[model samples]
Target: MPDLSIQLLPGLKLKNPVIAASGTAGYGDEPNRLCDIADLGAFVCKGTTLKPRAGNPQPRIMETPYGLLNAIGLQNPGVEAVIEKYAPLWAGWTTPIFVNIAAESVDEYAKLAHRLDKVPGIAALEVNISCPNVAAGCLEFGSTPESAAAVTRAVKNATSLPVIVKLTPNTSDIVALAQAVESAGADAVSLINTLRGMAIDIKKRKPVLGNITGGLSGSAVKPVALAMVYRVAGAVKVPVIGCGGITTGEDAIEFLMAGATAVEVGTAALVNPRAPIEIVKSIENYMLEWKLTEMSQLIGAARR
Candidate 1:
């Protein structure tokens, strides 16, 4: 088979371009019992906050056609718990584990990153800027270029680990935001965090999600996600990690062609814990069938 290895970041490399999205994958240890954790390019742990959060009220998830809506509210144990609980476990695994961190303010992000700096097994840091369901200033940081850059800059200063800023799809110009983060010292950028969407229940006569609104992700958002990846890839110099509704190898190929150095599987993982491993196999088979030499050759292959 063709070499599937792709460099996700300048210094950070992966055996393949398939990674599990944060929040959906839980800790890297969750799926280790079901499949080989080493098979994935990387697994991002659930979003960790400054402190443990109960998350949004019940009915936090609702199924939609070919997609799902989630208002997870970044529920996670505090950063200390993450380092104490999962970091050691991850250190023993061969697959790189990127820690996804979320905070209400730039200062919070900085403090969290600083704490994680000394933790072992954390290969990288993914700043979660697109959390729409939080009541505090979570979404605000991602809604504007200045705030986005501010968070990126703060986190960059706090840690030497490779920083990948996760961008929210709720913004007006995602490309502009991507450029801003790149300029702010992001080693890479991941996009299409989640589309701000809502579901309504006629029988219940109210919103389906307890938060009234949630982030939409799944196969339904694939096209929008691919388009944004394509646009952002062209606009920024940093590598783009494409996410949002990716399920199959074909979907992954689409993102790779659009210029994503790697692809992240989210909701699919919830339905099947082995989804990312299957995706890695599927991509490998597809690469062989197409006689591709390296995964990087597929980047930006799609033309308008």
Candidate 2:
């Protein structure tokens, strides 16, 4: 059988390459009830902030043809609450947990990372600088290379934990963003965090999402994600984690071939709670059928 394990960073090693992405996986708790949480390489919890946020108003989510749009506004019970409530129990779980964090300012990002630095059971910090739903400290930092590098440098300096900067597809040049983060000390990068999109209620003649514009994610985004992974992976020396529309083993494999060291499951898990687990099993089956003995053989093959 193939060894699906991948070392995403110097100290952050995962048993497999399939991880439960932030937002959909819910603090590493809900999936444990729905499927074998152990099947996941790691769980990137929802966007944790400095203070609890009420999130956007009603109509925060709207389902599209093969996609789901959301402006959840990085809603969570704040960083301190997450540490006090979930860290202790997560400490016992074998699967690694990464707290996804979103902040309103560069200083806030560093502060959140510093706080999480002391929290046990937190395998790493997934810095979310690309949340389009928020009014501030969101896409602005991620859209520009200088600002993105600044945030990465800030978070990296604040935490002892491995920092994985999440990349936004809304940028003009994703490779530049990836390279900037890498230079600024990101341990790894996860790409394609929902493209900016909107939906209209023809009957009401108004926007369907309360926030006006939301992040678009699901099977519909797989192609765009694949392209970014291919481009950014080629540009950066650090590990790249492909995320966006991955739902099946083949999709995961496609990303690996495109040079992604790992994959994150998001909207797919929302549609089917067991999608992450199923993806893991399916990947193993694919390796068995193909007689592939290691994941390294798949990763970056397309680029070669």
| Alpha-carbon TM-score of each model against the true structure | 0.97, 0.98
lDDT of 1 by residue, 25-129 (tens): 689665457667788899898889999999999899989877989998888888989999999999988899999999988999999999999688889999999
lDDT of each: 0.88, 0.91
lDDT tens digits by residue: candidate 2, 1-304:
7898998877778989999899986786553577777778988899999999989997899999989999998889998889998999799999999999998899999999999996888999999989889898878899999999999999999989999999999988999999999999999999989999999999999999999999999999999999999999998999999998998889998999999999999999887888888989898998899888888888998989
**Prediction RMSDs, each to the true structure:** 1.3, 1.0
Error of 2 at 72 (Å): 0.8
The alpha-carbon deviation from the true structure for residue 243 of candidate 1, after best TM-score superposition, in angstroms, is 0.5
Clashing pairs in 1: 218-245
**Whole-model lDDT for model 1 versus the true structure?**
0.88
Q: Candidate 2 — which residues are off by over 4 angstroms?
A: none
